[model samples]
Target: MSFLACRVFEKTESEKTESEKTSPKVQKTTIYHQLVQMETDELTAGDVLIRVDYSSINYKDALAASGRGKIMKQFPLNAGIDLAGVIVESDNDAYQAGDKVLVNGCGIGEQYDGGLAQYARVKSDWVIKIPEAYDTRQAMIIGTAGFTAALAIHRMQVNDQKPEMGPIVVTGASGGVGSIAVNLLSKLGYEVIALTSRKSMHDYLFELGANKVVSEDKLGMSDKPLGKALFGGAIDNIGGKTLSNIIAHTQLWGNVASIGLAQSPNLEAKVFPFILRGVSLLGISSTNCPMPLRTKLWHQFGKELPLPDFEAIVSKEIALEDVSPYFDELIDKKHHGRLIVNCQ
Candidate 1:
């Protein structure tokens, strides 16, 4: 359907009373001002209904919200990819009312209505019980970006990455995934080098536990098939030549987990890094991650990779009314760190 035309209306007490009597089955209305109003019948199909407490902005969400990219396959769909909230209704045995749960990726804000509204209906299979250590807000603070970072680290560790090998580098270091990867990798005893185009965020990266911060310009591409091995392993958020450079410079037997294509999706690199150096370029997809692995990683995030200063990574917390402008800011690359949406 075309996006619901923008309009505003409020029910009078008499209208409310009359409507309640006329349609006892209708759910309460939720108005997301400047966006759209949603009710029970309007929600996308799902087995569980969540009272979304919080959702957070991601690059994809920015694209969808700002009408800049094909992030949303359906018009009028809710457009935040990460959500944490309490379950209010469920048709699945795995979850019940009052459970604190979260949904990330799985085509949310893309193929389905997502978490920007006060409530969302989502598949039970996509729902993860919030970790014991995290509150609703904290869960969204980590959101999809942090979760993807953790997934990248998990893949690297599975490939036998060790802290003693050498330093690990995180590209796009001021962004959500990069910042959390820096924090989590440092906490795991790895020397963390953060690379960013924004020189102003160097101190911010340091505060997030980066051992060093390097300018993106310093990581220039080379014609050589392999460059000097600078990082033992890397979590790359900006793809394209940045990713190729990381692969070229990764230590022998090291792995580089590529989690995004913010710079560009194209990769122009030789097979030397993989053939001669035994380097592995791993792809991370938090969206379609298998259920068992998704659950395990989230649990590990709570137990081992907890960000004690998660609030520090949140660049802003805005109400629904403020989302439109923030979308523009995000698409223009004018914002850094995570942006939390208070959907309550």
Candidate 2:
């Protein structure tokens, strides 16, 4: 080798030694705030660094992943809302290297580095040790969508809703949250009526345990503000006119949990249902849910909500690099079910 080349090699080795002696920080890069590249030293500082094994894309993830919605507060950010993995390093007393953990929402994939990459450095507070009955993949299969579904159900049940009270309607029934809600509600003995835009999903929704399947157009409002009472309660995933129609049709003293806005964000509804029939509109925000409740819900998911085949909800899986192509399909509401990401 030339003398200058040999000297450069020696200098590079010396620099590596120096870097090792002093822990170099993580340095992640972002392209258009959707695609993320994370190097060992690029991760943000935190009590623990996780080697993420899996993540899944939700509708919010589609928005951030496409750079179409202003959901991301910062640019050049990691953009997955859910992840499960093993801890590689820890500064907190509760966690150690190799401890399995999961993270969802809590401003991740938006205000902070998220789970799309193979590694993530996150606050100890944000970590939830994987429930005993669930592995990393199982946890990812449940993901944020399932977690939110469980939370919504728990809230309604706590408010005294019962299966015998009446049939429960789930809007956007083919999507992740709605599908899981249908399964869960049915498993718990509540009659489940699924609402979807596609008649094609009727059989699949039935297999997932939906007692009845109805089209969105069938739920359309009439000239009169209030329609004949149809459902006992509902899990309304489409927040706009569909929700309005659902509100108009709910039985007296029924409850509706508003979660997604696949159709639109506007809620064009009259107060007749709320005031006349004593219907309740329960707003569910799963992102900032308290840690205690989050842990409890995850435990319940592993126990009471276990699907016979978890992969049934996972309609597709893609490599980390291939995520962008699916964004258009998701944003246009062409995709059904959960899309898992394999970060390894």
Candidate 3:
């Protein structure tokens, strides 16, 4: 059967050798994306074939759609990092046909075919059974974004981070991951400080359980090696000077979980926070997280993390054909919260 999918293609130009490397006339790549009908056999070879029910948009997916970042490692592949569905068939004995499953990362949207289609074929090893407490849509709502947030919290707690330490700052506080992080942290009893550059989102952030909302421009954070200790720790989405500033201002022995680099990836700050304050910068990589820990975290979402305000976190839900426009919205900073896609 044929199904609809958003396929991303990469166009390349002639390459220049070492001698011409300095020239602006070097190799260049252009990205193109669109929705098309794809036959089941056209999918990449995999042990499990899933009828995708729901998928979600993330900054990473926006990167894929906008051609701004090198998100998809392979061209002409589907473009979604998270999906929830039921198995249509399975080659592995561990999963039978009709099993409910979900997938996040595992190189699906990057290296292999992904979940932007009405149907998907993926490795059996990459699949996780849908939690009993949630259906496909709810699973996608908590998709990769929530998964990464959980990872950050898990790692921070493992290193002894506590609510008693101080308020936990969540940068990019109105976006998908940040919104969920604020809710989860507050629900878990930590004081949550929502930090965002957008002045318009303060009320929304407050409604999401932020103890306080701080505007980036007003904060006037310093670029010094060490600043006044403000927060106990942070879950930072916007990187660059913001991350550096957060690092400088974090309390002693706190953990700063670095997730996204919306501002910039370069960290050009001093090591005073690390050396003097015992602050730890935890890197969260949801793409290739080990299956054991990944499954455990997904399981915890239905229980400990609970995420009672999940419905409030959804920014919009669209069909596969309408997925392209929201990418630009995300890159332009005109969108906040999660955007889910209904593949079927």
Candidate 4:
């Protein structure tokens, strides 16, 4: 069946019989096989059915949709890694029908059916209540990318990184995680230097609160184990040589949060930066982050961090049906900023 053939169904209280009122409601979801369609009775036990209002395309989502990376371990799985919506049916005491919630990573697109559809039945443990400050759209705008940035910042803060120390550099600053990191770190009073290969996005990055926008070429790789001490702290999204460069130039006792492997994953680095300069290389993993910490970071995004102009970061807003065409752009690295999927 065609994906567009999927239909949504909701039941009113009056429509339910006495026994059915307490029983979990069946939900029709846009499901994926070789094709897509609205399907019912797909939910397993202990799963909460969410009426997805919005979802966002991350690098992983793009990889999964295009079948480029080994992102989806299972075929015929729902695509899209991040979603925000309202709960329609719940088995968990922490949530109820009509509660706004969001789910990010936790192997959604990889290990289980994900959020590219009109509805999702996810494990209750993976569902986090959307903060009051954000609606479904805003939550998805932050999605996995913004959440990963916040997690990196939280780690840097724990390591005692302060604005007064020096500038915090964000490598791959035009991308989602890097963009959000630039905005968040700037808002927190750190001077942010955004590094991007796309020189065309310099003005855009500056508007997102980057104090300085530098070309990725400026971060020249060197054979020396220690380079000039430039950044006080860093949020590195591109790995390989870029990561090695960031490590070499970090100030004494500075922390560098390694969040992505957009570039090559291999790291050939000397131990001099670590043992001599006391630079700390922090590895950030958003996928399997503990629930308590995840909730806390989302709470911080809602209340503490100044919300960046999401419209500026949103490169495209397409419906679920139009998602396929954009995946190639994302995989090719031709798209900048975020791509939001309007599931509603």
Candidate 5:
């Protein structure tokens, strides 16, 4: 059976020539995306087939679909990075028909066919049985964004971070991962200082349970090797000076989780935070995360990390047909909440 998918591909010379033949004014775009019908046989090789109920639009998904970032490793693939649904078929005994499952990262969107379709075929190893705490829709609501947040927090705690150590400031607190991190961290009993570059999102961040909402302009970071310990720890999404400053201000024995480099990837800072303060900088890699830990984090989503305000965090839901135009919204940074795609 053929199903509709948001397919991303590069036009071959023949295809482009054929296109120019049809429309004399234009040849073809370098990277193109559209809704197209595809059969299971055309899907990338995998052992498990999933009837995808929902998938979320993430930063990487937007980047891949819009061709604004060099994220896709192959052409002729679907573009969503995370999905939740029910298993329809599985070659492995560990899974059976009708079991709820979710998949994020593991190279599905970039190197293989991904979740931006009504149906998906993925490696059995990439599948996680959705815990009862979250249905398919809820799973996509959290999606890859929440998975990264949970992994960051988990790592921080494992590194001996505690609420009593001091407040945890979340950088880039207006984005998907940052917003969810704010909500979850506040609920987890840590004092959360949400940092956003936009002053308009301060109220929204506070609504997500941030004890304090701040912007970089409001905070004066020091040039000293180790600045005043204003925070116990930090979950930094935007790297560069912000990351360096966060590292400088983090209290003794604190843990800092570096999740993204939205602002800049460069870092110029002294080693005092790490050497003198005994700070731990944990690198959270959700994409290529091992299956065992991935499953554990997803399970934690159903348990301790449940987001009652997922509705607030999930700003919009669009049909699969409406996926393309929305990438520009993400690209322009006009959106603050998560956007989930209803593949059904």
Candidate 6:
């Protein structure tokens, strides 16, 4: 993925090295990814240019798309990690015009020009031919969260976690990653427990196949450093104290997959869980995950990760023009599940 070029490239060699050592470069530009007129010169050099049909608002997207966090490691940056659309033009032999494809991660949102706009020119390697089982709009509904969820589950299975072991807990249950994890774990026959701070989502979580829905505060007990064993395994979205607490309470030989940090970055935990119980804390970084693994996981998402009604997770849909207002809502934890953006 290529970032929109905004710098003049005039620094001395020493200054350039120092800058590279210190921080990634950023530049200011008026290139709006939201409901703005497209200019001919805006397309990046690539083998494929897609006219996006759908893109979803992940927590990171809200941070980058709405200019909340400095997630634009490079600027004049386009900010979206997940996109599904049709190929309007292609120069690569592997793809032709009119083919449907979807792309998530691989720096599309963070540094490269991304899917939030009506047009995206990306390398052929970054595109995945759309799975025959789904369409563009449906793919965006699953998007990056679903893809990452699949990867986490795959890792757990590879580590020998099976449904017969015991219950699996998913934190931030109402959000994209946690919700998909809940449904996937449930479908795979693990007794599923959803941890959410929003009391209003109790019923909704159950609808997604969570056998029990518990308050996040229940996991936030007084810091005893270790607690009674509770979950057999877990997929954690909120890190910090909640994750530390989960680590303390995980069953013997249980694994905890750390996928996000919506709460706090710091993790405070005693080493007893790993030493005594052999608990595994697997760190999941989906962005730079190798291509072969990414392809396998996405294929799984298309074939086996289908929920009973994925549309249920789609709480709201917004036009490209209206996405900015939702950023504050996301930061305040006022919404649930996935928010798809129809870019038309």
lDDT of each: 0.82, 0.79, 0.89, 0.81, 0.89, 0.80
lDDT of 5 at 68: 79
Q: What tens digits encode model 6's per-residue C-alpha lDDT throughout 1-344?
A: 33221111112222344567678655434323344455535655678988888888889877775555667666565567888999988889899899999989988877677777777878888898887777898888888988888888888888988787678889989999988899888888899989998889999999999999999666544566667887889999999988998888888889899998888988998999999889999988888888888877777664666543578888999886677677668877888988888887
Model 2 pairs in collision: 25-41, 26-41, 26-42, 26-43, 27-41, 27-42, 28-42
Model 6 residue runs over 4 Å out of place are: 1-34, 219-222
Reference-based lDDT, residue 157, model 6:
83
Stretches of candidate 3 off by over 4 Å are 13-28
lDDT of 3 by residue, 51-100 (tens): 99999888888888679888887778988888999999998999998899
In candidate 4, which residue pairs get closer than 3 Å at backbone N, Cα or C atoms, i.e. clash?
Answer: none
| Clash pairs, model 3 backbone | none
- What candidate 5 gets wrong by more than 4 Å, as runs, is 12-29
TM-score between model 5 and native: 0.93
Model 1, stretches more than 4 Å misplaced? 1-34, 219-221
Give stretches of model 2 more than 4 Å off. Answer: 1-37, 220-223, 304-309
lDDT of 5 by residue, 52-73 (tens): 9999899989989888788888
Clashes of each: 0, 7, 0, 0, 0, 0
RMSD (CA, Å), each prediction: 10.1, 10.7, 3.1, 11.5, 4.1, 6.1
Cα distance off (Å), candidate 1, residue 294:
0.9
Q: Candidate 1 on 1-344: residue-level lDDT in tens?
A: 12221122222232345566567544453322247655766777999988888898898787676666666665567778889999999999889999999999998888887888788889998999987888999998889988898899999998999998789989888888888889889888999989987888988899989988988666554657799887898998888988888889889899899888889999987899999899999999988999888888888765766664687888899876567778778767687888998886
Error of 3 at 126 (Å): 0.8
Error of 2 at 196 (Å): 0.9
lDDT of 2 at 24: 66
Q: Give candidate 1's whole-model lDDT.
A: 0.82
TM-score of each: 0.88, 0.87, 0.94, 0.88, 0.93, 0.88
